[model samples]
Target: MTLEPDLRDDLLAAVPSLRAFAISLSGHVDRADDLVQDTLLRALSNLHRFERGTNLNAWLFTILRNLFHSQYRKRRREVEDPDGSYASRLTVQPEQGARLDFEDFRTALSTLPHDQREALLLIGASGFSYEEAAVICGCAVGTIKSRVNRARSRLSSILKVDATEAIGSDPVIRAALHTAR
Candidate 1:
């Protein structure tokens, strides 16, 4: 029992709407699109179970939401950013408009221990609430906070990137560092 041709067309058309909703809920566009695709497939396969008289849009949204929840549960322990775009913000325009700090920060981040680094990335960089970070990392809120603090300390100490040095790839951090210096 698959969705009819008309229903399939409708599902394809609703991808954008489904994606937007998924992004809002999950805060990651790549995950949102993947969720939408999965929802469409599930809707098509389970079309027979759908009550024809009900709203199809609502049904699809529900399917996508359910899938998102399932993924959250399955990956609670995994540091999975489906979109992989979440990081420190602020536009970077170097002397030649090069994006250098990303590679630098990536190298800096790679050197930290897993726990400390994950905590800082989730809280300081990705803007995840301590509770959300804890849920994502399978830890207590206090533990998450402690990890974040420790991670920042360790990175600052290791990189010697001088939190006070006007040396970020972005204006915001550079300005702050300049002011601090």
Candidate 2:
């Protein structure tokens, strides 16, 4: 069903705040603009889920936050090596050792069971607390902790590196491994 005129107006009025929040979360104007657009589209599509007389702003913000987190999780696994420069940098065996190590870590991460991987990503890469991860994953806090621990151990074994040894210079990779403990 189409939104009523007043509801449509309210949604349009929320755009500025949504864009600002997106910018603060993304730290890039272009990405923030895209995020705001996506948020509005999602809100429009899900208007039936919105309750009348409730805080429309809160609902929109929640949608934006969820979209950001979902995108963040997907983006963390991607390498932005548009040209050959990044791969060439890794060719220097000594100076760019971390680059190679990051590749290996990424491969090992993909081999993890979905549950363990999800827990690790939420807690480590996304910087969510155990309680928050538990809520997101619909599991007990202890279960999330267990999954993270198991995932870390499995990754360490697969990469044949000491659990405490620093693997890659990539901040997200380092955060995932370091915070898994």
Candidate 3:
């Protein structure tokens, strides 16, 4: 399929940002890159259906996000890797407390409702304004804000971190927890 030069250029320009968004959504670099590749292929195949003047970035993002969710649902039934088998094979240093904290945070994050998690990530991690998130989520700005608030509150509860208390003494982690509260 031949894409117009301008359209091809625009799509190429969006790749890095799309991969970053995918990583934020998937939390796995390899999976994120694969998702990005799949998204691009789908976009190219559906190029004829795209409206010339529409927001291409938003369209691409919507496709990538939906793909992630669909894949996530399918992965739910898959078996996990054997516990220490995967971890023990990796060389670890004695001073890797930060990794443990990250694991805890990731666990807590995965517990949040999908809406809240997406809203929180779009605003907090992806640097999207509430309005932009609203547009992307196909909802009101107030709805996006509410989701982010609820997500943060739920995470704080799940992690058992008080607004004034710190997690792992890491300022970045502490600020994230505090801000959510």
Candidate that would win on lDDT: 2
lDDT of 2 by residue, 1-181 (tens): 7768999899999999999999999999999999999999998888889999999999999999999999999999977898878777774337477778778878999999999999999987999999999999999999999999899888878877675455756777777777332
Off by over 4 Å in 2: 84-181
Candidates' RMSD to native: 17.0, 17.4, 21.6
Candidate 2 structure lDDT: 0.88
Q: What is the C-alpha lDDT of each candidate?
A: 0.73, 0.88, 0.84
**Residue 40: error of model 1 in Å?**
0.9
Worst 10 residues of 2 by lDDT: 172-181
List ranges where model 3 is wrong by over 4 Å. Answer: 81-181
Clashes of each: 0, 0, 0
User: In angstroms, how far off is 19's CA in candidate 3?
Assistant: 0.7
> What stretches of model 1 exceed 4 Å from their correct place?
1-3, 80-181
What TM-score would every model get versus the actual structure? 0.41, 0.47, 0.45
What's the candidate order when arranged by decreasing lDDT? 2, 3, 1
Please provide, for model 3 over 1-181, each residue's C-alpha lDDT reduced to its tens digit, 9 standing for 90 to 100: 7778999999999999999999999999999999999999999888888899999999999999999999999999665676767666777545467667768888998888899888888887777888999999999999998998888788888878766355665544554455733
**Model 3 C-alpha lDDT versus the unseen true structure:** 0.84
Look at candidate 2 and tell me the lDDT of residue 5. Answer: 94
Shift in Å, residue 2, candidate 1: 7.2
Model 1, 167: alpha-carbon shift in Å?
53
